[model samples]
Target: MRCPFCGHEETQVKDSRPSEDGAAIRRRRMCPACEGRFTTFERVQLRELTILKRSGRRTPFDRDKLARSISIAIRKRPIEPERVERMISAIVRQLESMGETELPSSTIGELVMKHLKQLDDVAYVRYASVYRDFRETQDFARFLGEEGLNEVLARER
Candidate 1:
């Protein structure tokens, strides 16, 4: 690696460790010429996965987009940032393990709902409002009844 401080041609790795999330490796390096030290992170890039929309259009699966949507639902909730990152990584890993390059948008939404349901009821409801395209209060009422969420809500109240 090139030294950032002195722009030296070579640097030696002093230490290496796996990141907390295990998504990347963190390396500590030293520039012998300047005696400068720095850290670098390395991550593995898997094959690109595509989203197969209902309209027959295809687009690359975007992790940021997924995070944004989930974050919206989780707004004002008590979920930890680490938990959110873990959830996103888990979903991506699950999809990648399926051995399919292209996946349906519905599949992604369902997975989000599954995780959200376990994380927080309010977030799940908020996400379901958008994902299921809920129209009226009756839709929520029906959802609560069908999902047996009525008891959970009552208990929380």
Candidate 2:
């Protein structure tokens, strides 16, 4: 592998092991030219997937982008990082197992919303506000009421 630190042509792997979640392989490497050490993760891609956007545009599916969006929703919401990672892995696995090369963006969004609802209400609302494009306070009220979450929120207080 190419060394990220000094742009060396090759690096030696000092150690290799499965990650905590077992979704990826973690490798520790050292660059001979600069002796810089860094960690890398390798994941298996079952196939190349494409995202069918709402606007009739197709784009390659990006795991990092999905992780970033979930991170934004769960930021400071008391959810464990390992749980978030597993959630992401589960979502990806579900998508891949569907046996389709292309999938609607809504599918991914709904999956996220579903998982967030089970994970945390605040994170769910945070993601829904953006995904559903809430325009006013009434939107949240309507959503909470429609989803029968107001009672849950009230009970918590």
lDDT of each: 0.90, 0.93
Per-residue lDDT of 82 in model 1? 82
lDDT of 2 by residue, 79-98 (tens): 88999998999999999999
Query: What value does the lDDT take at residue 121 in candidate 1?
Result: 91
Alpha-carbon runs more than 4 Å astray in model 1 = 1-17, 25-42
The residue-by-residue lDDT of candidate 1 on 44-104, one tens digit each, is: 6577899999899999998889999999999988899989888888888888888898999
Q: List the residue pairs that clash in candidate 1.
A: none
TM-score (C-alpha) between model 1 and the true structure? 0.76
Best by TM-score: 2
User: lDDT of model 1 at residue 99?
Assistant: 88
Return the top candidate by lDDT: 2
